[model samples]
Target: MTRPIAYPSGSWPPRMPADLAAAYCGEASVDVFLRQVKAGSYPQPVVKQGRRQIWAKADLDRAIQPTPDHDIAADVALDL
Candidate 1:
């Protein structure tokens, strides 16, 4: 089985699939979480930044737990 990604502490880079299997994806496998990611229902797999791929913290938050003020229509605009 694949190891679960640990939740980061404070301003940590929003990389890796967190413990969202049960929290967000409703399944108990990171595979399911990953599927959501693949389907764009969860955090994106990667973001291009010249020669680097950065996971935008904002995108991660909006994916798992969308803010009330966040416009649903504009939800698809990934900072990718």
Candidate 2:
């Protein structure tokens, strides 16, 4: 018999998908998020367990912070 894996509280599971629409503005998709990382527009996520990529909540918060010259609408569109 195989034992099930367990996760600690507040940690995203390895290979788990983010709730992007709920967590991001303008209904961003996971692919868009990955694209943003590839484009150097956002912080790169760490690979968990040498197999999965997980985004830190802090990094996402930093990416969403308002800036004077930033266009929120454009960012949303690009990520959607």
Candidate 3:
């Protein structure tokens, strides 16, 4: 006997691509999202099942969070 894998309701692929787009770009554009992934700037899928790539919702959410802007001036004080 084999144990069944567990997943949240409505959690699956095809949906993941779109979800990633919406989470990152605020729209359903997987093409843009995939491009970023290919460029190594975005988070890749958490897992690969067979031929399908799967991403965790939490991970995707984290990737879309806004990064804090760095201020170079703040790091250095000019003495004139």
Cα-based lDDT for every prediction:
0.54, 0.53, 0.54
Model 2 per-residue lDDT tens digits across residues 12-42: 4333334432134222455665566778776
Q: Candidate 1 — worst ten consecutive residues by lDDT sum? A: 16-25
State which candidate has the highest TM-score: 2
> What order do you get sorting by lDDT, best first?
3, 1, 2
In model 3, state the lDDT of residue 25.
40
Listed per candidate, the RMSD to the true structure in angstroms reads 9.3, 8.5, 13.5
Q: Model 1 over residues 26-67: C-alpha lDDT tens digits? A: 444665666666787765546555644445556666666757
Where model 3 places Cα greater than 4 Å from the true spot, the runs are 1-28, 70-80
Error of 2 at 68 (Å): 1.5
Mind giving the per-residue lDDT tens digits that candidate 3 earns over 1-80? 32223333654434354444444444335565666778865667877677677666666667656558855455345321
**Which pairs clash inside model 1?**
none
Q: Which clashing pairs does model 3 show?
A: none
